[model samples]
Target chain A: MDSLNSLIDGFGTALTPVNLLWAALGVLLGTAIGVLPGIGPAMAVALLLPVTYGLEPTGAFIMFAGIYYGAMFGGSTTSILLNTPGESAAVVAAMEGHPMAKAGRGPQALAAAAIGHFAGGMIGTVLLVVLAPTVASLAVDIGAPDYFAIMVLAFIAVTSVLGSSRIRGLASLLIGLTIGLVGLDQMTGQQRLTFGSLQLADGVDVVIVAVGLFAIGEALWVAAHLRRSTGEPIPVGRPWLGRDDLRRTWKSWLRGPVIGFPFGAIPAGGAEIPTFLSYVTEKRLSKHREEFGKGAIEGVAGPESAASASAAGTLVSMLTLGLPTTAVAAVMLAAFQQYGIQPGPLLFEREPELVWGLIASLFVGMVLLLALNLPLAPLWAKLLRIPRPYLYAGILFFAAVGAYAVGGEAADLVILLVIGLIGLGMRRYGLPVLPAVIGVILGPAAEQQLRRALQISDGSASGLVDTPFSVTVYGVVLLILAWPLVRKQVTRRMAARR
Target chain B: MTTGTAGPTPGPKRAHWLRDHSELGVSVLLLVLGVLVLTDALTMSVDLTQRGPVGPRTVPLVVGGGLLVIAVLLAADVLRGGRGEAEGGEDIDLAEPADWRTVLLLAGVFLANAVLIGPFGFPVSGALLFWGSAWALGSRHYDRDPLIAAGLSLVTYFVFDSLLGVPLPGGPLMGVV
Candidate 1:
């Protein structure tokens, strides 16, 4: 009953003309940028963050929520038309979407994706409304050991699951942790790895790290391979679905949210796993199974919905427990920190208006995304035609400005350059970049929790493992670490038997 | 493992050997980074505080230790002929030799922006960056390119400075902006 009143008040806040305008603008700009190749939601958010600095916290976050959904919606446009999935989550959409586009069902493919995104987002938002308070209350019961253990699970899951090789991922995570270790320690007020430099004392900014890795690093890597065009994008018409298409799509959309939200709500949630699983499920369940590779409407509908649902799912942990499982969510956490808003159980109590208003704006943003994207997809697709040189150059231009604006320091630009080069090397060597970003964001938080747990237990190492929640979290981490090796052995044995 | 170390041949075999060991750079890079972290942690100044037994040094020590272990393991794996898969599922052609010229050109453009942005300010420096990058990307419409670059840079300068109220150095256009 109390939640219902707050949600009503939230609607009142979000319904303001200025706030609605911000949502509209955010969706428009997000789709425009997201349609461009080599730019994803994380990069878009990181680049646009500086623009939101002057707004009130509520208004700023409303726009951010809009951009988040808008980017997800726009990603499918690129995947279907260009066969260039900007991020891994959209790779599933590309599998059947591009083929649909090739078979002259581009409009239908786009319609399925946009509507699926809408359904998933709306249902996920409702789930968030009902579930967030309960989860946040439960999260409050978890002590520091459990918090520390959860961070360990996040670290292990990201390193082991996202990338092809565990070594590279772990190495990247170590690099991020090292970056996080810089500046003064929160409790003791002593520097760990600042190397006595005044500039280093404040540590590396997450925005700088994000822009360097995603924008500048991506541009540099793409430049190295800028020899040939991938292919001409399939021309798409107005996004429209027939009665038959809608009938086939509705069940998949429902199934997608069911499958996607659980993966996203976990501390270890990433969109990649859920989207792939949704694709496989649809392929196995479809009545027209032979059309799976060729323009299957169910193929685009299910995975796109799953991807968006999982994206919304990531917010559950982010809001309730202050954990970010994806790169974009990491940036969102940084955005929250920028506003001095720490999302956790107390957030709903202390700033009920801000939290509820943000959630309300997510629903508003979804409606805005669906309304804007259904017709503008063909227009947004034109963004793919931008000259590669100018597109990347513009990226660098914004990246430099974004880095410079952080602290108004010249040293930040140099740091961006160095980090960008490191990012380039990591990309060339096939290392996953998300774990490093996650490590940088979560490392300090995890360390603080560990220290707190130890302080309470008089420095006894066993104190960290005493709690059931902590033990279970650590057990999960161990299983995640060992699962790949065990699976490899099992596969090898099967091969030998054959 | 024996295929890499005990065998030598020219042609495709030699190329295969190079590919197999290409990731030595990554393992070596990890090792160097691990040593750097440990050395930095060891040399950091220690100061006691009102906070209890867990000092700031503890986390760094643990992280540095973890890095060293990962480095050693990665090196061993590489030696045992384990190799990372080349990036796939993207539009990139990893098989083609890297086009260093364009990359270096773009790098130079970024460096030039860094050097020029402070002295020349955002508008002038930004336009130069835009034009230079377009050229790097093989766009050679000399007359039209500069015009677009100027328009984009000027528009950005105004929007950020006036509407957003974010201070950007305007160089010669400072007073006008």
Candidate 2:
């Protein structure tokens, strides 16, 4: 009932004419940028971060919420039409959706995707409204030790779970930490690695890091291997669903949010797991199992819903715990920080209007996305036809401008170029970029929590495990660290016995 | 593609050996970075009163030590025949030898933007950056591209500076902007 009241009030704020316009504009621009290849939601958010510099925080965040959902919708459109996924979460969609498109059911596949995203987004936002307050209330009681433990959990999950190689992930994380350490120390007023540059005093901006690593580096890497052409986009008529498709998809839509919501709520939140799980579950349960590989409507419906649901779910952690589970969420965190807003337990209590308004905007964005995308997907597909050279060159231009816009310092551009080089190296080496991003964002917070916990315990190391919650969290982290080794040993022993 | 293959033909056995151990280059880089971190941490000046129990030095030291351990482990893994697969996530083809010519050209474009932004302002330099990058990426529309690039830079400058009021430097165009 309390959540309902807050949501109603949130709607009152989000539905205002100006905020609605922002929401619509956000959806429009988000879908446009998200349609382009090599640019994901994270890059979209990072690139546009400078544009929202003038808006009030509430309006800006509402626009951001729109963009977030808009990117997910746009990614599916590309996956279906171009067979090039804009976001990793949309990879599953492309698998079945692309096949469906190839079979001359492109419109049906697209409709299922947009509708699935709408259903999943609505359900996910509802789940968020019901659960966020309770979660925030619980999180408010957690001490520094538990906070530190949770960050450790996040670090472990990002490094080990997202990428194939743990070593590369850890190395990437270390690099991020090094970058994070370049600024002045929070606890002590001492410089660590500034090397006497005045620009280094304020530390490297997260925007600079994000734009450099994602935008400039990606452009350089792609330019090196630029595919001359990305073939013609599969043409589609207006999206329409048949009776059989409707009958098959409705249940999967209901089931997807249920599977996806919890994955996003966890600290290790990512859409990949739930989407894969939803795809496998739909494959196993669908009556039309024969169409599983060759483009099943259920495959499109289930995973798209799961992906959007998990995106909404990620907000649970970002808002309540101030932990970012994905690169997009991390950039959103940077946005919040830019506004002098800390998005955690205090955000809900201190600024319920802002928090709830942002949440409410998610709902509004979804309806707008479906309305805009269904009729305009072909227009969005036209973005794919953009010449590769101009597209990448424009990306570099924006990246340089975005970096330089921060404090209008030429030094920022230098930093961007260096970081862009590092990003190129990481991509070449197959290092997962997310860990570095997470490490840069979360490293300082973890350090603060660690220092605070130690200070409270008068420098006792065991204070980190003083509470049951912290102990359990650390135990989980340890198990995550040890699981591969233990499994390997067990497999070897079983083989020897055989 | 013929020119992009790794250096003039070596014996098959030697080529395989080099291919397997190529990752050691990365491990060596990591080791060097670890050493640098440790050296910097050791030389960091700390006021006596500012030294809390953990202090600023602690995290860096730990990070440096962890990097060393990771480098050793990575080296061992490579020796044990572990391999890293090239990413297939994007439209990129990692099997193709990097076009260093293009990469270097793009880098020069960025450097040119950095050097020029101060004198020419964002519009002029930004146009150059855009055009240079496009050229590096193999767009040879020398006639049409500059017009497009200048248009993009001018619109971008006006939008950000006038409508948005973000205060980009005007440089020589200061009066016009």
Candidate 3:
């Protein structure tokens, strides 16, 4: 009943003409950018962050939420149409989707993807509404030491599990931490590593770093690598799904949300794992296994649904516990903090309007996305035909404008360029950029909790492990950190035996 | 595509060399970066805590120590010639060479913005910024391209200036925008 009332209140807020317009705009821009290869939701949000600076907090967040989900929808189009995936989560979709396109059943493949996205998105939102409060209440009892332990666990999990190489991921994370440590030390009010510069007093904006790395670096990389080709646009054909297609896909859509939600809620579990699992599940379960690498509609439907559901599931954890499961969630967490509204257990009590409004807007936005994407997917496909040179150049131009708009400081442009180069290097070296992003966003918060815990214990090293909860949290962290090594050893032994 | 090719024993000697050398290069770079960060963190002034056992240096020092350990491990792995499967193996072959022409064109666009933003102001410069990028991207259909870019820049200008009140640089052509 309480959830219902709050949802209704949220609908009231979201239905306002101004808020609705923002939601529509967010989804539109998110889909457009999401369709672009190499750009993801995090980059899209970061690019739009500067532009949203002046909107009311509630309105701004509503739009941000729309863009986040909109990216998920937009990503599937490229994955299915082209073999190229705009986001890592879309990789599974591409495996089956591209084959389906090649078989000339492109429209059916896209229809299944859209319908599956709708199903998963709706289910995930329901879970969020019901689970967020309960989880947030549990988080309220956690002390500073426990928080510190959890952050350590987060850092370890993200660096080790998210990327191809643990060493490179950790290195990238440390680099982000180093960047976070720039400017004034939060505790001492003393400037450290500022090198006697006034601009350094204010720490580098995470938004600027994110935008520069994702948008600017992506633009530069695209500009330098994109081939200019005028390929004929893939014919979208009929948008409607046949009865056989519908019957085959509905089960996968249901199965996907079930499989994806829990993974999205977990710390290290991202969209990629669930999406891959969903794809494999569909392949193994399907009556038509031979069609999987050909033009299986289930193959396209399952993973696309899983990806969108996982995206929604990430929001549940983010809004309630302030733990971001993906890069976009991490950036959104920063955006929330920028508005001075910490999203946690207290958010429901303190700002019910904002929380519910954002949630309601998501439901509305999902519907809007379906309406826009389903009938007009062909138009979106035409977006792919845009020459690479102009697309990338536009990205760079917008990135520069966004960076300059933030602080009006000339030094920011230099920082943007430097970070862009670092981003390029990370991409080249196969380092996961998400961990670095997470580290930067969470570094200060973790430091604050650690300092607080130390103060409570009177600076004793044992103080960190003194409490039962903290001890348990540390134990969990150790287990997570050790799991990879232990698993590797087991795998090696098994390989030797084989 | 032949499964019977040499019983699937990793790769050729040249492949092994390439793998080991790249890892070595990366390990060296990581070590350098780790050491620089560690030294910088350690040199910062720290106030001793009379009441608590932990101080401001705790987290950085721990992170620094962790980095050093990882660096050492990475170095050892690289030196020992432990070759792992190449990352993104599927896509590596698909990647094409860098397009320098597009890079230069984009660079020119940014340079133009930097030079003109202060003098020509937001309206004129903003329009050029949008139009130039659009043109560069391959929208040779100038009839609709410039109009679309101009509209986008104008809306952006209004949103930044009027709605959000972000105080964007209007430059010399401010009133027109």
Best candidate (score: DockQ): 2
lDDT of model 1, residue A325: 78
TM-scores, in order shown?
0.93, 0.95, 0.89
Tens digit of lDDT per residue, candidate 1, span A1-498?
777888999999889998888888878877776677777778888887776566788888777777777888888888999888866678888889999999899999999999999999888888888888888876667788888888888888888877778888898899888888888888877876777799988989888888888888887887777646656788878999999999999999999989888888875547888888999999999999999888789999998888788878888878887777777787887788778787766678878888888888889899889988999889888888777777778888899888887876667888998889888888877777888888887898889999999999998998799988788878888888788789999999999999
How big is the positional error of residue A488 in model 2, measured in Å on the Cα after superposition? 4.2
lDDT string for model 3 (A142-259, tens) is 7788778767777888887786677777877887787777777677665655777888779889878888778776666555545555335466775579898888998999999988
- Name the 10 consecutive residues with the lowest summed lDDT in model 1 chain A: A223-232
TM-score of chain A of 2: 0.96
For the second chain, the TM-scores of the candidates in order are: 0.81, 0.84, 0.58
True contacts kept of each: 0.62, 0.64, 0.38
Candidate with the larger lDDT of 2 and 3: 2
